[model samples]
Target: MILITGATGHIGSVVLEQLLRKLPAHQLAALVRDEIKAAHLQAQGITIRVGDYRDPASLERAMQGISKVLLVSGGGDEDGLQQHYNVVDAAKKAGVRCLAYTSRALQNPATLTNQLMVRHFQTEDYIRASGLSYLLFRNILYMDTLPQFVGPQVFEKGIQLPAGQGRVAFALRRDMGEAIANVLADDSCQNRIFTFTGAATYSFTDVAQALSELSGRPVEYTPIEEQEFMSRLRAQGLPAVAVERITGFLTDIKNDQESTVTAELADWLGRPPTPLREGIKEIFKV
Candidate 1:
C-alpha cells in the first residue's frame, strides 16, 4: 500500500482525491496524526495510520506493510528540518521501497538563501543519501497564495510589495497535486526529480492589471523598499515571524529567483496549466 502523510492538509487532500480516481482506495493508505480526524479517509476504504513526523516511533508503526510513501514537506516550524529528517530515517528503517517528497524549486540559489529554502535542499540531500528510490517534485510558488499576499484591499490601496520587475512562474496547488498523483498511480515508478512550474511567468504589475480587469476597479502596482515593506506589515499588527516569511518571498522575487518557466507541469497533466488571469478569476471570484 502507498501511504500519504499530511493526508488532511491542502495539498495532501487534493493528492488523495486525485489518486482515488486513478487507483482503488484499498490500495491507498493515509498517515494522519489523529485517527478520529481521518474518519472521512477511512470511510472511503483507505487505511488510516496515526502518525507524525516529529515522532519516529509513530512513523515506524504507520509504515508497517507500506511499500511506497509520499513525504509532504513539513510546515515552516522551528523544528521543521528535524521533523523531515525523522520521517526519512523512519521510512528507511521501515524498509519502504520508494519515497517521494515535495520540494521547492529555486532558479537562483544565491538569491534565495532563506531558511525555508535551505531546509528543503538539505532535506533533498538527506533523502538522496538514504539510498531509497525517490521521486522529488520541486514545485514553484503556489498561485493560490497570491490572494493572501495581495490582501483584500488590493482594489483600494493597490499592490504594494518589495518585488520590482521580477516575475514568478506560479502554478496552482490542485494542478501540482494532480500531476503528483498521476505519477504514483502508475505501477512503473522510478527515481526522478523534476521542477513543476507554470507555462508562463508574471510580475506583480501583470497581476495588478489582471485584477483590475476582472474586478472592474483600478489596481496599481507600487513597488516599495524592503525596509518599508517590513514597516507596513508590522504596522498592520503582523508578528515578526510572519513578517520575515513574507519578506523572504518578496525578496526572492525581487532577485528574480522564481522567474524560471517550465513545461513539466503541462507535460505531466497532458494539458496546459491555468493562465494568470484565468487563475486569478478562479481564486478571487472576480
Candidate 2:
C-alpha cells in the first residue's frame, strides 16, 4: 500500500483525492496525527494510520506494510529536520519499496541560504543514504498561496515589496499534487529527481499588469526597502518564524534565485501547467 504523510494538509489532501480516482481505496493509506480528525478519510475506505513525524515509534507503526511513501515537508522549526529524520528512519526500517519527499525547487538548491531549504537538503541527504529508492520533488512556490502573499486589497493598495525585477515560476498546488499522486501509483515514474515549476515566470510588475488587464483599472507595483517591507509585515503581527521564512524567499526572488522555469511538472501532467493569470484571477476573484 502507498502511504501519504501530511494526509490532511493542502498537498497531501489533494494527492489522496487524486489517488482515489486511479487506485482502489484498499491500496491507499493516510498517516494522520489523530484518527478522530480523519474520520472522513476512513469513511472513504482508506486505511488511517495514526502517526507524527516527531514520534519515531508512531511513524514506525504507520510504515508497516506500506510499500511506498510521500514524506511531505513540514515547517522550519528547530525540530523540523529531526521530524523528517524520524520518518525516513522508520521507512528505512520498515523496508519500504520507495520514499519520496516534497523538497524546494531551485536552479541550485545548494546555493540557497534559507533555513527551510537548508533543512530540506539535510533531509534529502538522509533519505539518500537510507538505502531506499527515492524521488525528490523540488517544487517551486505554489500560486495557490499567491493571494495570501499579495493580499486581498492588492487591486486597490497595489503591491509594495522588496522583490524588484525578480520573477517566480509559480505552479498551482493542485497540479503538483496530481503529478505526485500519478507518480505514487505508477512505479515507472516513482524514483527520479524532478524540478517542478510552472511553464513560465512572472515578476511583481507582471502581476500588476495581469491585474490591470483583468480589472481594466490601473494596478501598480512599487519596490520597497527590505527593512521597511519586513517591518510592515511584522506590524501585521505575523510570527517571527513566519516573517523570517517570507523574507528569505523574497530575498531569493530578488537575487534571481527563483526565476528558473522547468517543464517537468508539465511533462508529468502531459500538458502545460495552469497559467499564472488564471491562478491569480481565481485567487483574488477578479
Candidate 3:
C-alpha cells in the first residue's frame, strides 16, 4: 500500500488526487493529524490514519502494511525535528520499502532557510541509512508563492519585491504534486534524487508585467534593499525570523541563484511543466 503524509496540505492533496487516478483506492492511505479535516478524503475511499508526526506509535500504527510512504515536510514548529525524526523511525520500524521526501531547492547550509533544509536533509540521510529505497525530490519555489505574496499587493497597489533582474525557475504546486505521484507510481524510481522546476524561467519584472496584463492595471515592480524590505515586513507584524527567511529567499532570486530548470520534471510527469503565464491566468482568470 502507498501512504501519504500531510495528505490535507496543498501539494499532498494534489498528489493524492493524481495518484488515485492511476492506482486503486484500496492501495492508498493518508496519514493525517486531524481526522475531522480529512473526513472528505476518508469518504473518497482513502484509508485515513489519524496520526501526528510528534507521536511515533501513532505513525507506526499508520504505517502498518504500508509499502511506500511519501513524507511531506511540516511547517516550522518548535518540535519539527523531533516530529520528523519520529516519523522516520516509525517508517523504518514498519519496514516501508520505498520512501519519498519533499525538500527545497538551492538549500545551501549557510543560508537563513538552512535550518528548514537541514531538517529535510537529515530525513533523507536517515532514510538512506535505514537501507530503504528512497527518492529525494528537491522542489523549486511554488508558482502560488507569487500569487500569495503579490496578489494582495496587486489588488491594493502593485507588486513590490527585492528581486531585481534575477530569474527564478518556479513550478506550480500541481506540477510538483503530479511529479511526486508519477514517481511514487513507478517502482523503478528507487534511490534517486530528482530536482524539479518549471519548464521556463521568469523574473520579478516579468511577473509584474503578467499581473499588469491580466488585471488590466499598472502593476509595478518595486525593487528595494533587503534590509529595508525586511524592516517593512517586520513593521507589518511578521516575525523577525520569518522576515529574514523570506528576505533571504528574495535575495537568492536577486542574485540569480535560483534559475535552474531541468527536463527532469517533464520526463517524470510525461508532460511539460506549467508555464508562468498560464499559471497566472489560472489564478487571475482574465
Best by lDDT: 1
Off by over 4 Å in 1: none
Off by over 4 Å in 2: 189-191
Q: Global lDDT for candidate 3? A: 0.83
Predicted structure with the largest TM-score when compared to the true one = 1
Listed in order, each prediction's TM-score against the native is 0.97, 0.95, 0.94
Clashing pairs in 1: none
Question: Candidate 2 — which pairs collide?
Answer: none
lDDT of 1 by residue, 150-195 (tens): 8888888999999998899988999999999988887755789978
Please, what are the lDDT tens digits per residue for candidate 3 over residues 133-199?
8888989889887866675657567767787888888888999999889889887745999999888
Ranking by lDDT: 1, 2, 3
For candidate 1, the TM-score is 0.97
Which of candidates 1 and 3 is the stronger one according to TM-score?
1
Model 2 over residues 1-286: C-alpha lDDT tens digits?
9999999999999999999999999999999998898899999999999998988999998899999999999976678899999999999888888999998877667666455878887888999898889989888889887777677888789888888888899888999999888778886534588888999999989989888888887889998888898898899998987887788778788877778788889988888999989987886678
Locate the minimum summed-lDDT window of 10 residues in model 3.
Answer: 107-116
RMSD of every candidate to native, in Å, equals: 1.1, 1.5, 1.8
